[model samples]
Target: MYSPEFRREAVAALKTSTLAEVAANTGASPSSLRRWVGRSDLADRPRSGRPPIQDTADQVVEALVATAGARISGKDYSTRALAEATGLSQSIVSRSVRGLTVPLTDVGGGRELSLVAAGFPLLILGARTEDAGGEDGGGGPAVPPRRIQRRIAGIAAALRSAGVGRWAQRFDSEHRQVPTDNLLELIAAGGSDRFLVFDPLGEVPVEVVAESDSRVEVHRDFAEFLEALKDLLAGCQDIPGSLLDLLSARVRNGLEGVLWRDSVGVDASRSSMSSDSMEISSWLPKETRSITEHLAIALREEIIDSAYEPGDRINPRLLSRRMRVPRASVDAALRRMVDDKLLDGSRGGARIPLITTGDVLDLYAARMAIGEVVLRSLSLRPQRYLVPVQLALRQVEASAPTRSGIDVEDADLHYQQELARASGLRESARVFEAVTLRLRLFISVLQLDYSPASDRIVSDDRAMFAALSRGDAKTAIEVWRGKVDNAVRHMAGLLGRRRFDQELWTQLTRSLA
Candidate 1:
């Protein structure tokens, strides 16, 4: 069904264009368009039937049975195969199978679906039942235990191809009734690894099956079921030994994409598995940033939050132990901060630097010089970067109302950095990044409260963004230079109040002797 807004748009177009034109453009049939025209309301009329069942436990059981039946009959099972066998819609079958399988790239660089080991018990039971019902109740031809073992071996091979390990460890630890020595010996003899090691004679407990049934009953749709499964696996501790319970945990973590490669051994430029991995990567709670980078960011935050005072010495060894990171990584991060002028490392160890008025002026002067070049370059093609520049300015405006001075300072720094990046000059952007880092340290050390000046700060940023949007390089540079001068004046006043030495300040400010 079309949304109300979509119907409104179609009806609105009818006043200016013919019904055929509107229908062709909107992809709605002419008959539907006729029914929608001249209506007082554009909203859809309510339907009067019960909705179709998109997913249910019964549907899942049916699909599992079909898959098992097909496997025993020497036929490949797919969504279409299951639909034909069970006389259900393909959509229903697909939804049921989604929780039961994982897609992995085969050696030939094509995606192939493999049933997870968690579902193996259900398949075995289904196959046994199908055999028993066949051709006059003599249990027809029994499925060979060797064939079942081979299937288990295949599932293990599929998982291994995708770089997954320890998949069958839970099965072995929780479900095995045999002694550890015997299991180890079996493994050493190359008898099907942990994946195939299950007690075929063991029966699933009634309570366990009932629990799964009750849980599935609460999930009204496939999405709810999927979300519940994710939450279950995410917080799962003391998972049960039953195969159904194991299925819930394994289905969430066992799915891994196989890296695709060409016949000549070079990695493929793009593949189905790569695309799937990209989609799934966002949901996985894993850090992509390196430890050193994370440490640097954390240290910067600590400094801005006043965790360290001026002239306070930083010990990397103690920091590594406190943060629980490698000493070398902490040292690397400290060195990086020192190079950025955020920490002073001159006297045998890193310490927070005491900011003087002269130091503040020098920092602002460096920024002004870099800003002039960056702003001028960006003006050459201002329209190409207007969106991101405006976004950065908006962030400053958003942080202006917050009581946290650090938030406003960080946002302002980000705005400056965005302008530098928008210039398209890579080398200048890198240099400007270092200058901004020093500026961040300058503000933090002086404990500048940006809340009072946030309005003016945001106003100045909006003016700068507007000037850049109009390709007015001169106005943009002047605005940036004025901001630098204002900052220098504030710092000089602050230092004067702190009783800084006038003689040393004058000597340091002398450009030439």
Candidate 2:
């Protein structure tokens, strides 16, 4: 029906009617009746029925399926069996598993993951009180425990200041709250090389159709504990706590954006901003098994949350400004992004060649087949460039009387100079883009204020220029890369947000072909 009132009424009536009653009244198949109850796309006869469930709990169910994947092995668990294991409704299990795209089985209402066949690890985050939800009195389905909102709020704030990970909350059918936690883990051994966090609560999460070594799971308790900590996250309203919320959101957003920028290509930017809070260095996590692990989870969620949306650039300089951490640290984090295959770039080695003869032949053939347009554009450039170069030379002479080129004066010449400067400008832009990315990563690691990262980057640049002038591309790149890598290592050393710049970058660029 066109009117909301009509839809509401029809839905109300459909929900109350028995399955047989709907079939008798509609004279349609039971399948059609079921579809009609939920379908709103239909116009006049718009199939209406019970109100659609909020589906928020699907995240919790999906988390359960992931955790369960780690716990079970070999043969895939039946949907019924998975339902029995994670205490989720078969429908929720099915939906979330499908939604999250994590490896899972959907039998009737339950979902299962075939970790063994896929060679994927079963991930298990830390547990909380709710993952072990109370049994339903009717015994038909088990509900996740209610999350302690106030407590979670407190923890999220503490995490903000303490430089620990984030803890998010969700409610179940029984109004019980559950937590979703993400922790970073580094694996370079097998399968896909990825470093972006995939909290459904955040931005992006990869789906595990069959399974492979690319995924890792934390202790179920960690995820559960994060749920319990939700009250702490939810209740805060001031200072460190209030800022913590924003930081938590930013942390999630920034990381995910960096992770996916490449796939989305040069068309997107990601960012998150938190209000001023106390400096976090001294308060950094001190425990070996601290709640810090959840930071990765929070970041993952924010990344997933930001999927498809443009966000702040992950430039280390800006992030250093925004995060108040050292720019050097930010650079390091960007390197990690490179390592994880989430993002990629190059100063000198971009097209240097990264394949064996056979592979090179294949790569070249493929490029030749599809890159004709770009090739033509490049070939036609020199011809187009001569006039611009001559004009630019004249400008340089006008600007600095006796200079051959490099003029910043004389509009037209300056303009052509700027045009010719495009390559360098583009390079710098790309580098800064890469820098901003690393900055976010560094911020997560140092958990310091934002400015320091920028300051540190400027400091590192002093040596950077010197290194570049020496004609030592590798050394210059190394020195520049080293400072950033150090920041990443520092960030990873914190607890769970391990460094992966080297690996990620290699993987991402390697596949540019």
Candidate 3:
């Protein structure tokens, strides 16, 4: 795990390097540090249950001694002025600055923040100030569009044998554009020397938005940016390895929601409908605000979305960049999720899990045995999980992808999560999630067409819900058992049809050892 000081150092390094490079050098993931940078809102989310009691009075006094640049300090600015800059409420500001450790010896028209005698070391860098007279947010000089185009062309030339495409000539956004048929067109037309106009805020045509295609990717910078473009293009042709890493990074930006809609088999119109309009308020818990909790959820969603597949190693450094938090926070979240059983591996490193047929069978048996007991008890207390189960059902239906493997997997996982929550067995919930993750990983790695199976999952979930409606615990348990059995057999059949990767199998054996 990374220490707080190290995390601060990594965040400070963001000044000189791109998030990707910083991650590569520091062993800190890009996403973590990104969050630590002015994106504090991501980390300040409220948690469920009791709030932690604060020694606010003491904190207010100590606030005076803390360095002004690093933290909110009386020496930096007045309470009202600081409140305006930080955009915090007056009451919060007042509570934080109400007391003083030392008497105010001077009276002046203006308040100046005082630094502590032994000022804190500069670990984390504060927010950046933009360049004067620069169009982009960065402080450096902007490279001309022609220079970027030529650089991309050179990279494309080098990667031609690897199925790299030409420089796309159009963009949806000003900085980047993902053309719908950019990959297919490049392959068909052969590589061409062309440059797309740079538009950071270009409006995508209606058709492009409607189709959710990835035709192009544009960026303002060269080098690393061009490398990302090359890998993304290569991914379109089904090449593996680093392309997966590229996808993992882009996944943080809603790549699945944007690019893979059709191939994944989603109900486009239904997806377009806002969740707010859906009747989820009755079942879905109020969303948690904690960044760690939120990151946990986001990571799970990305995993199910197949941003990183089985056998794909997670780069804590790169992941930190994607999640925009510190490596320490990412490590904490990973440990928590692993405890929850939604992820595999330990703090040494984490990966999306892989599974064998025996693992599938064992998972089913456990679910059947444990679920039976839970369902039987729920019959005596039907009120407990009933609402949550219904809520899960609603999410599955509302978010249903027409034939998407990930969507189906998500639905199944959501149902299981709700059931575990209802069972009032936190450990059980975690185990169930672990099982679900394994199954999802298997499907993603194989890229199996589980469309029909997805439909069946929803149907079975509804049957269970119907049984729950009548307080028929026995029927619900039976339905759940049948679903589990079916999943095991289905997975076993798929596994039989495909040969296992011997290398991955060996690695798994060693890891287990």
Question: What is the descending TM-score order?
Answer: 3, 1, 2
Alpha-carbon lDDT, every model: 0.50, 0.31, 0.45
Q: Is candidate 2 or candidate 3 better by TM-score?
A: 3
Counted clashes in each candidate structure: 0, 95, 37
Error of 3 at 115 (Å): 42
Each prediction's RMSD to truth: 26.2, 25.2, 27.2
TM-score winner, 1 or 3: 3
Off by over 4 Å in 2: 1-456, 465-478, 495-513
Q: Give the TM-score of each candidate.
A: 0.40, 0.21, 0.42
Q: Model 2, range 261-285, lDDT digits (tens) per residue?
A: 1111111122122221111111122
Among all windows of 10 consecutive residues in model 2, the one with the lowest summed lDDT is: 111-120
Candidate 2 lDDT (Cα, whole model)?
Answer: 0.31
Model 1 has an lDDT value of 0.50
> Quick one: ranking by lDDT, best first?
1, 3, 2
Candidate 1 lDDT by residue in tens digits, 254-332? 4221111211101212111122222221211136445544554444433432234577666464345335677778878
